[model samples]
Target: MTPPPGPPPLPELHWLEQLIERGHPHLQAREMRRIHVPGGPSFPVHAITLGNPDPALPAVGYFGGVHGLERIGAEVVIAFLQNIVTRLAWDTGLHRLLEQVRLVFMPIVNPGGMWAATRANPRGVDLMRNAPIDARERVPYLLGGQRLSAGLPWYRGRLGDPLEAESQALCELVQAELLGRPFSIALDCHSGFGISDRLWFPFAHTREPMPHLAEVQVLKTLFDQSHSHHPYIIEPQSAQYLAHGDLWDHLYLQACENTGRTFLPLTLEMGSWLWVKKNPRQLFSRKGIFNPQIGHRQQRVLRRHLALLDFLARAASSHERWRPPSDDRAQHHAQALAQWFPT
Candidate 1:
């Protein structure tokens, strides 16, 4: 005998909806798109926003789940959102901070992929590699991105097609909320990297440094100064490997079109291998390889990153106070080069 079929179980989306309702009249949630899987249930791409609406105010976007199999990414973002929402009723300092900065969130960018337990979306395209940009230098074969088949890992959508819905939604949200501001930051979280965590900035599509390397160095310095024992390795994505169609590189380039604006995009690639090392049995599950499957371990992961997210919010709110003046900009730039691109 066979069991009856059931609707796809997406607790994250459900929880997100409940969260929006709980945050009624405060945070606004918009459906970016409706993702319809051929045989499975459809999912809504939600973008939640709160804080100042003025373009003059700086903003920070917190994103996750660009690769669906990495549920921990989405969970970390939602945990931070939850932290903010729950504090809204009583945290006067938070309310003041919100008045000065904008916060955008798309905690589950690829819910369809999460439903199917795949790295690629339901269409088999990797959302992270679906942007139109190509690597300026040679990239690792296949892993960098490929058009061979959707059946393969790291499959970019077919050439000449429009960006994937998830990718488009994210790009649109960033352009509308984060770009054009005097200063903005983006943090897209993911897992399944090496034994150590990493904070990667732009130019994943090329070996060349981004125009804002000096600002990146400042941000890294501030973070290090505040959390001396923080468990993150901050550097350019190029420091690891280059890839084609990297969405951040494409978006960062678009942001640079405005000389007056500063957009510092960062990706938090969590070190899932540490979890797998402690509990080697997690290797048997594809999702487990990218998430902390144990109850307490997952809680710890969420707790630790909350501080980083909060710091970004506070940093965006006060970017003017810290960004270098013209007199010191070159000095900062030289310092950044020596540290990251030592001769």
Candidate 2:
């Protein structure tokens, strides 16, 4: 068997490198190269570390494109890196933030799916719903008045287990690098359904909050406060609507159960409708790259969203209290919710 093909170099990738070079002097960016399969693509997962590489500095993991069709998530992660790079060149505050924390980012985890524009990998498995959890069951979906099941878009795979090569690669990376480390937070980006902007936590199998529920609330409050002026962003548990074996649940929840480390995972669901109008191709192409118009609109949103992330990075790095319950919390959360679930 041979290694998987490397991700086709994109114009945006160079832009990201330049941004980091210009904006963040304290941070170091390195690529973690891995073989997707025995004879598959050799994809690179980009890691940007701030402060010391030592375990002392709490780490934050940011990932996008666990679902191949959700290319917008990957683009957003790139945009965030670019903005942070651009901002830090002139901003002392951001520079200080970079000096305090480390951020590990895997912009595109499913290169095979990304290349083909399908939600699942080459084997047809939904990576997001493919964690090693018990609530992993397949259900049928009626889309456009047609029945779709695990064999389709959100297929759980054979016996509701993760069988995709991409899934295995991600699992290996987490165990080798993330587990038992001082990772403070993790954010997985995704899109579809144009639902409200939300922050989803783990334990989708049960409504009961995990032991770190208070920490989850605190992080949610911080996000709400940071985007208070923007008026779009809310906190929604992943299992609120349905239960499944999601990536976050597998990482923070499952990992916590095994290692006893307090790691909080948040799913940042940005509103896709804002970009859908500009990029109609996404609506049609199950595995097609986003149209330029939709891509541009997404870029704008990504820029603003990146600014908020920068603010969060700063706040978290400083170990500042994000509490006191500001009036803007509800409004911003509502605004974000309205964008996806508009009344």
Candidate 3:
């Protein structure tokens, strides 16, 4: 019998296809949706799953490349998957860890944009800003999100329309895979801004603290204690700026409907300014600003975030042990307010 067709021609997708081919039997990859670009061949948005499939098990959803220019974001997630797939051969410990966790990866979420070298998808919509939710407060002219023109950045798409195909695909995946469980964590990676790495939580549409602020505090505490010298600035997305139609914000708000479910969505905004500062020539290249052009720097960036990704997986697995106790929830809440909502 003949084998299925290979991934479409693209470096990131090609690498992912290779991993899927190599890691077969140990992992499963499905094309969530096929994205077609104008005057170009279609590309598949694949979702790779590993570990337990039990609804009772906690899950972690790792997403990247929501913006096509942020190739580094997709690379980081791909690197982590490569590490896990290779280790599954000999890492008995990881095998045990998988028994209690469900891992979902959608490494290249916006392939059309990546192919065209634009931040927006082929339809010109920004997937990250393509959700249905609107900002409670006034957002910046165009950066926050706009319906003015798809030609402008951060386009949210026309009002009263269904979500863009990519946005709908992501929401469907999260709802089916992550929201049904008792607890789940999502880490969506992106770059192309700032000078320092940042870990942001929800409420990108508002400045108000999320319902799970206390739980966020506990996770932050665990991360700090375990990786004492970690160089991430953990805070709410609103701390930097509020935006309209953040997909995570939409999913997070939806997750709140199930009072028993705990869904903590995080955005890893890796600062690209550091890369540009080290090599100013990147300023002129569209992709260079969002991705590490230097081979060594790309490797270093991948190495730096692998631990954090692994930490989230372990944290989700052992959540019963480290998640804040009922007796301490109030204290954690108070502390969270003081730390992230300082007056």
> Best to worst by TM-score, what's the order?
1, 3, 2
Residue clash pairs of candidate 3: none
- Model 2 worst lDDT run, 10 consecutive residues: 138-147
- Which TM-score value belongs to model 2? 0.73
Q: Could you tell which candidate, 1 or 2, scores higher by TM-score?
A: 1
Worst 10 residues of 3 by lDDT: 2-11
Candidate 1 Cα misplacement greater than 4 A, ranges:
1-8
Distance (Å) between predicted and true CA of 269, model 1?
0.3
lDDT of 3 by residue, 1-343 (tens): 9645875557899899999998999898889889999899799999999999999999999999899989999999999999999999999999999999999999999988888888998999999888888899988889899999988899889998898777877888899899999999999999976999999999899999999999999999999999999989999999989898899999998999999989999999999999999999987886759888888999999999999999999999999998787898899999999999998
- Whichever of 2 and 3 has more TM-score, that candidate is 3
Question: Tens-digit lDDT track for model 2 on 2-107?
Answer: 6357754433445556655764565666665442533554455455655545555555667787877777777777777666566665878765665666666677
Error of 3 at 133 (Å): 0.5
Give the per-residue lDDT of model 1 (tens digit) for 196-309.
Answer: 999999889977778898888888889999999999999889898889888998999999999999999999999999999999999897676999989999999999999899
What does the lDDT come to for candidate 2? 0.59
Error of 3 at 110 (Å): 0.3
C-alpha TM-score for every candidate: 0.97, 0.73, 0.97
Which run of 10 residues does model 1 get worst, by summed lDDT? 1-10
